[model samples]
Target: MNAEVRVNAVFSDHMVLQREATIPVWGTGLDGMVVKLQFHGKQTEAVVANGCWRADLPAEKAGGPYELIIEAGNQLIVFRDVLIGDVWLAGGQSNMQWSLAQTDHAQAEIVDSHIPDFRFYDVPRVSYEDGIVHSPSWKVCTPEHAGAFSAVAYYFAKGIITELGIPIGIIGCNWGGTSIACWVSEQVLTHDDDLRIYADEYNEQIENFDWDVFAAKEAHYKEQIAEYDRRFAAGLREKELGDFPAAPMNPHYFLRPFGLYSTMLLTVVPFALKGVLFYQGESDAHRPLIYDKLLTAMISHWRTIWHHSMLPFLFVQLPAFGNGGNANGKEWPLLRESQLIVTEQVPYTGMVVALDCGDLEDIHPTNKKPVGERLALLALERVYEQPVESSGPVYKDYLIDHNKIILHFDHTGNGLEARGNQLIGFEIADETNEYVSAQAVIEGATVEVWSDQIVNPLAVRYGWANYTEANLVNSFGLPAGPFRTKREERQ
Candidate 1:
């Protein structure tokens, strides 16, 4: 005798399956039992093996309010009101996980969030050593649900719905303030010198830390969260709530090495995804020098796991905060530079520059609408082949004539224009590596930079300072991302 048929929690009522992709439906049941699936007037069947069974539903068209029926060993499971359409996974840190209720215009947005074509599914934060755990099911977008959903994810889905006129499903699998190393396997972390420090810390914690103490704290945290949810449902203001639970400095599920990837992302591997939208890297800002390698590795690892070599990946560049200077004085700018490097080097990737949408004093900017819309633009122009202005001016190449450096750019929507009286954040440097403020002007889609102090400029940098409020942008009003050309590039 074996256990009765049980489906993976990922598949349930009100779920939206990916359109134009092989739909994998898997579950556990009695070994060798006959399993059958019936959906959308087509039936596919497979035999249970090793205590598990699977069926592949054919690629479907966009519209669906269909029912999915499964039968195995006298046990039957049915999912109703299911949809078929585009599915995207939302990954990264607090910004990606920030809820709509905490964002700007929350009240008005919630009132108008009646779109039935958009849906969201959140994978609860849980860790397992060996097996998979089911948490929550798919939720349709209503005012109540939309209020608590990820603001960035919600806006991204909304943009897609408006443009494509198809059902959109967003799987929110993110944790706030989580480091990149936590989202990757320990083995992968160990391979890179930049990431091994986190792995070593986790190993030390496992040897010395008290598991019982951690368990007690975790239990208390969950209780507090439950109480907070209750208070929030009763119309309590967020500011009125005291403080959310924070894990101790020692070992915790979200902080431990490979914790999130093993728990949150492993079970969802190989599930069909149209693309991925990531917003993280703030926690890894301390080690800015290694961020580029770490993120590149993470992307490669995920693409391999998904079996999609060229999956369309788009990410939000960290917005400005705290005058763009960390206490260490090097973290923020370096991290932003590393983000730009990935966007330029990665084959199927894009980065949304939030240069003009940052908050000077707040780490978590409440203006997430532009972040989401920018991400959607990347998908629209690059993934869907839509002819749209997806970005602002990007440095293409430069020409030097005696004392002047002329900069050429791509994606100069309409033409270039300085947001202020004159272009700020421009610097000219000579062979000595000393830089001075340069006079800059927009000439159509090109910028001419020069400084009287430096007669022969050897390099040029824009928005290279810690607290730069650059005024250079294009006609579409998207600001140019920060960049600095090295001495080698000047040749």
Candidate 2:
């Protein structure tokens, strides 16, 4: 084995590389072989280090179906079907992490998709670090394999390939049922005073907690929750909302705040990507006030670490989950506002509305195409400089006309069109907490709203419940996400 040479990013036949930038090509080699990379008539060289060699190839403009030959002395290896194009990192929670196989039309989608130009690089679905694994192999797009990948990511890649007509690579690194905090770095957490307080405490707790006892307690809680679910399903309200309360609804992924963020920051955020696509907020809904700060911190922290100022990040507000319960929808509203605040605080960030894309009964919506597609649209318009209309009727401005409220919008590209029928789930409330059906008319750039009962309307809220018939879409046919804007901020 003295004269043998080995390579990684080697097993794959067709490799995708991002063009117009210096791509780091690194691997192990003989002690003094002088490893060289040859592609598209250009050759780059590097010296071996501890039996390894790495070099930054001069940036090449996108265009190619080329061959790459890596040589270490006389030992040579050739990687075929190399293409240079756009690479995107698709991340976030279950909505973003949902595989094509789980969506409504999985079978049909997977069967029809066979574009070979699109490739996927799945970072092992791990939240913790095993250190940096040097680049995963890119998988070619095929029906049998596409279904196993993230539905949102697959579709997004497909869209990009269809439009750009170039090789596209998607990096899917998302963990389901995880929160924003879990994806942050411990170093950053330690740096932030607002976060360090809890991080220190969590560290102490982890060190002191009796693992056996904690595990048993968690198991007990799960068992108890299961019993409550059985009771609730049997038409029993005895312990439905009363017994469970809020804390026990879901198991805490990070029993303490700042724990998750710190861990992911170091382990997950190393890859160089154009931007981020976020889909979360269901877990942090309860602490809406704090969420604004938390979200702002995460965005800032990510940009700072990546050293990319003004990175484009698109997020989705929480979709309606849990079978149409009596949830006042307070959390959802607060979280939406938090999302809005993030955009206002962080530059180049956008959001997608999913009010009409939720399951009335189940929390995880079966359709993920819209979520990912809308994200790509934002990228197309803002990132890729492609012409595309990618937003619904957004709450723009509000005018107080005596006791009436006139709500305006910005991106109603083709004007607002309520899906399938009437404008539902809109309520106008006065100073007193009393509310009633509000009359609304979509005209020009505004939706004039009012209710006779509240002639001096102080607030206007749309779809502020777990289950409200709210399907207001713009001419572009995207549903308006759930939101509430009052004359004064109540949340």
List per-prediction Cα lDDT, in the order shown.
Answer: 0.83, 0.71
What TM-scores do the predictions have? 0.88, 0.83
lDDT (C-alpha) at residue 324 in model 1: 30
* TM-score of candidate 1 relative to the true fold: 0.88
State, as a TM-score between 0 and 1, how close model 2 is to the true structure: 0.83
- Point out the worst 10-residue segment of candidate 2 by lDDT: 245-254
Expressed as tens digits, the lDDT of each residue in 343-409 for candidate 1 is 8799999999887677765668899999999888888999888988889899988989899999999
* Counted clashes in each candidate structure: 0, 13
RMSD of each: 5.3, 4.4
Give the alpha carbon lDDT tens digit for every residue of 90-199 in model 2. 76777777889999878988899898888776665433344655545667889867887888778777777777787787767566666566666666567866656546
- What lDDT does candidate 1 reach at residue 368? 94
Name the regions of candidate 1 deviating beyond 4 angstroms: 1-3, 127-135, 211-251, 323-328, 487-491
Q: Which candidate is the best by TM-score?
A: 1
